[model samples]
Target: MSEARKLLVLVGSPRRDGNTAMLAEGVQRGAAASGTQATLRFADDYITDFLRDCRTCRRSDGECAISDRFRTLFLEDFLPADGVVFCTPIYWYGMSGQTKTFFDRTFCYYAGSYPQSEEVLEAMCRKRIGLVLASEETYPGAALGIIHQIQEFSRYTHSEFVGTVGGIGNRRGEVAHDPRDPMRGAERLGREMFTRHYADYRADTPRSTGVWCG
Candidate 1:
């Protein structure tokens, strides 16, 4: 059997019981069923002040210049995960601002600011990534812009973009009631996290944003 891996799920929705959160919960359920250790965090739970531009702060050590909750999130929570799952609700054709804030904090991992970035960043390369997104828009491409960013980020970080589950619902907790069973798709994607490749899985199918399941 594969050894248990630590999976970190980041819920980017400020609404604790929103559609995205339900998707995240489904993923967690699947992770737990597979006997993987999983942890869930809300983006709003982290203190994300606007990244102050400065030259004299800490950078060479490969540490974030900011001394807020973001630093703790990076050094303690994010880096330690063997895999990461990003669950967000689309807003204005992009991820929620709170979630974006967490992502924007990655600049702290740059060579100048974070001297040990190479080590931590290299460690991240070994991890896998999954995405679960919800949107109010019903169009097939509603979440593509956000998905593209995530795909690029995965590549830049050297993490394998394992799979995605994009759901559509304007109301809170609609993911559970969607006809397509997006929660089921999210759970399946989570279970497949230990074993599948997104490229191979989507090889024969055309990319469609309306397609919520993997």
Candidate 2:
């Protein structure tokens, strides 16, 4: 067996064990089946009251200057993780505030004053990104904008966009009842993600380099 890849899962639902959480757990379960080490972080708790100010955000270090709950964890865990999964509930055709805001904080990586700032930012972009969303609507269009945002973000950072899975639900744990069996699809996505072993690739140089998408 190959080395197990590390996956950082960000759950954006205020309800820790809500529908989105269950869907995320399906992905985790599938990743584990393929020998992946998946870490789940609740984005609702991870996002703090910290707002952005370029002066304060672009510190010497490649991290957010604000002393918030997510600052240290994002900088530390993100560096070592092989892939990231943003599991969010749809909010008015957009991602949950917790999910979008957390991603906005990534601006600190490219804005930092460190000499290797660009290199660090580029390296940070190498990880694979996946999305898991839950919406109350029956139509899949609710996740369109959110999907486009991830696609654009991946293009900007040079990260590989894996794919997205969406479910229809409103009440807690309702995603599990999705007629399409979304949890199974989520598990399959997670399993296939690591089966390719693309997450293990690393760019050792601090300069510009290509990322492994497969």
lDDT of each: 0.80, 0.78
Can you write out model 1's per-residue Cα lDDT over 1-214, one digit (the tens) per residue? 7778889899998888899999999899989888888888987787557655646655565355676787667667788888899999988888889888888776666545566767767766767899999987778787888889988988877678888898878888776777888899988877778777445234687766653455
All models, RMSD in angstroms: 5.4, 6.4
Q: Estimate each model's TM-score.
A: 0.85, 0.83
- Which regions of candidate 2 fall more than 4 Å away from where they truly are? 56-63, 114-116, 196-214
lDDT per residue (tens digit) for residues 1-214 in model 2: 6777888888988887788999899888888888888888887566785467767555565445666677555766765788888899988999988887787776665554545566658667767888899999988677889999988887776778887888888888888888999999889877766454333245673533565544
Predicted structure 2, TM vs. truth: 0.83
- The lowest-lDDT stretch of 10 consecutive residues in candidate 1 is 54-63
